[model samples]
Target: MTSSAVDPVRLAGERRRIFLALFSALAIALHALEFLLPSPVPWFRLGFANIFALLALFLYDGRAAWSVNMVRIVVASLFLGTFFSPRFFLSLSGGILATLAMTTSRKLGCEKIGPVGVSVLGACGHSVGQLLCAWWLIVRHDGVWFLLPPLLLIALVTGIINGFVADALLQRLRRHPPFEDIADGAHSDV
Candidate 1:
C-alpha cells in the first residue's frame, strides 16, 4: 500500500507512453533523413525507424509497439509532405501491420527465436500490406502478385539489418542502468 510499493499498472502505462514518444520522434527523424538523403531506389530505405518498433516489442508489448508505429508514420508523413498520398497510407498500413506481427509473435513465447525471427515475420506482414494496397488501390492488376517475391526478398534483407540494429540498441540500452531504472519505473508490471 506504500508509495514504495510500485503499482505495476501505472508503471506500465507510463513506460508505454515514454517509449511511444521516443520511438515516434526517432521514426520522424529517420524518415526525414531518408528523404534528405534521397536514395537511388525510390521506396528502398534503411528502415532506421523500425529500430524503435523492435525495441517496443522487447520493452513493452504488441499494442504499445503498434501505437508508436502509427503515430510515427502519421507524424513523419505530415512533415515529409507525404501525408495525403496513397504511398503514405500504403506504407503506414504495411509498417503497422508488420510491427504488430513481430511484437505479437515475440509475446507468444517465441523469444528464443530472437529479433531475426521477428524481423522476418514483420517483413512478411509488410509485403502483405503493400500487396493489398497495390491490388486494391493502385494497380488493380493480378500481376502485382508477381512483385511479391522480389519485395519479400528486399523485406527479408532489410528486416535482418533493422533487426540487428534494434538488437544492438537494446543491448546498449540494457547496459545503462539509469535508463533501465526509468524504463522499469515506467513499465513495471510487478
Candidate 2:
C-alpha cells in the first residue's frame, strides 16, 4: 500500500466523532440561519436545528443528542451574539429538555414509536422548557403561561414538520451499511 493509503478499519473506528462533528455543524448552521427568519411570536423559532439532534439520537444515543444540542446552543449563540444572555439560557434549557424528551421517548417506545414520534415529543419539550424558563426569567408573572396554548400549537406544527424530515433522513441513512454499523455500535475502538 502507498504511504498515504487510507485504512477502512481506522476510518470506521473514527465514525463516531466524524458523525458527531457533522451533526453538530449542520445543527449550528441551521440555528444561525433560523435567527434571520422572522417569527410570528417574539423569540419563537421554527427550530430547524433540532432535526439534527433527533438524527444524533437515532444514529447513536442520548449522549450524542445532548452533545449536538449543547454544541448547537453554545456555538450558535456565540455566532449570533446571544451567549451568556437570557436568550442563551432559554436555548440551553430548551435544548437540554428537548434531548431528554427525545431520548426518553425513544427508550420507552422504541418498538412502538419511530423517529417522527420522538421528534415531535422533543419539539414539544423544547417549547415547554423555553416557555417556563422565559416566564421564570423575564416575565416573572403567573399570567405568562397564557401563551402556552398558541405556543404548543406552533410546537405541534413545527414538530410534525421536523419529525417528518428526520424520519425521511433516518430511513435513508439506515439503509446505508456504514451508518447502520455506526448506529448498531458495530464499529470498534471509537
Candidate 3:
C-alpha cells in the first residue's frame, strides 16, 4: 500500500495519547512546583498548572482538554497528600467548573478571543465554584459575600498573567521546529 494511503485513525489516536501524556506530565510538574512558591493567601494559588490546561485546549479538542484537566487535579491532589481534605474537594469543584466553562466557551466559537479571554473566563468560573463550595460546606456565612470584590480583582490579575504566559508559550511552541513537525503529523508522538 502507498504511504499516503496508510490508515489515519491509528496515527490520530497515537498523536492524541502522546499529547495527553505530555500535558499531564507538564501539569504534574507545575502543580508540584507551586508548592515551593510562598503565598500569603492559603487558597490563593498562582495557577501555574493552568498553562497546560490552556495549551491543551488550544492544541487538542475540548474533550481532550477537559479529560487532561480532571486527571491533573486528581493526580496532583494525591501527590500533595491532600486527597481527602476540604481543599481537595474545593479544588475538584473549581477545576471541573473551570474546565466546563472553558470547553463551552471554545465550543461557542470564543476561541478567537485568544488565551487571555479564555483564562479570564476560566478564573471567574473557578472563583464562583470556590465561593459556592465555601458557602455551602465551610463558612455558611452570608457576610462572605463581602469578599467578592477583592477575590474577583485577584482573579482578574492572575488570570491575565496566566493568559499571557500561556499565549507566549503557545507562540513559542508554534515556532519550534519539533512542534511544527508534530503539528504536520511528521512526528507520530507529541
Candidate 4:
C-alpha cells in the first residue's frame, strides 16, 4: 500500500490556473467570433469577449480578472496573426483600461451599480483607450478626435448588450452543476 499527501495550496493554485486558462480560451473564442461578424466601421468591435472579464471580476478577484483579460488578449492576438501590430497595441490598451475601470468601479461601490453599470464603465474606458492609442500611434490627426462621440455611442449600445448577456450567463451558470463548482470557488477567493 502506498499513500501520498497532496498540498492543498498547490492543488488550489493548479485549479486556479486551469480555470484561468479555460476563461482565456473562452475569451479568445469570443474575440475571434466577433471578428467574423460585420461592423459599421473598420475599428469598431462589439467586445463580446468582455463577458469573461466581467465574470472574472464578479466571481474571482481583480488580479484574476486581469490575468484572464491579458492572457486572452495576447493569445487572441497571436492566433489572429496581429501580434506586435498597431491593432494589437490598441487591443492591449483597451483591455488594460477596461479591466482597471471595471475593477475600480466595483471597489468604489457606485450607487445602484450592478454588472450592467460596471460593464458600461469598462466599455467606455476601452473605447477611450483605443481611440487614444489610434490617435497617438496611427491617426495623429486632430480630426481623429471627432470619432470620440460616435465611438462612445457605439460603446454605450454594445455595453448594454454585453452586460445583459453576461448577467444572463451568470445566472445560468449559477444554476448549472458543472459550473456551480466554479462559481463556488470564485466566491471563496473573495
| Predicted model with the maximum lDDT | 2
Window of ten residues with lowest summed lDDT in model 1 = 181-190
**Which regions of candidate 3 deviate over 4 angstroms?**
1-6, 176-190
Candidate order by decreasing TM-score: 2, 3, 4, 1
Q: List the residue pairs that clash in candidate 4.
A: none
Per-residue C-alpha lDDT of model 3 across residues 1-190, encoded as one tens digit per residue:
1244756666656666887889888998888778668878766777778778888787666777787788888998899898978888888887887887777776665436678888887887777777777777889997766776777777788889999998898888767643553452111223
Clash number for each model? 2, 0, 0, 0
Candidate 4 lDDT score relative to the true structure = 0.81
Query: RMSD in angstroms, candidate 2?
Result: 3.4
- Local accuracy of candidate 2 as per-residue lDDT tens digits, 1-190: 2223778667654776798899999999999988878876786888989999888887777778888999999999999999999999998888888888988888778658777788788888988888889988988898878888887888888899998998888889888766855544221222
> Which portions of model 4 show Cα errors greater than 4 Å?
1-13, 110-112, 176-190
Candidates 2 and 4, the one with greater lDDT: 2
Judge candidate 3 at residue 164 and give its lDDT: 98
CA shift of 60, model 4, Å = 0.5
In TM-score terms, candidate 1 sits at: 0.83
Each model's lDDT: 0.74, 0.82, 0.75, 0.81
- Sort all candidates by lDDT, best to worst: 2, 4, 3, 1
Error of 3 at 7 (Å): 3.2
The weakest ten consecutive residues by lDDT in model 2 span 181-190
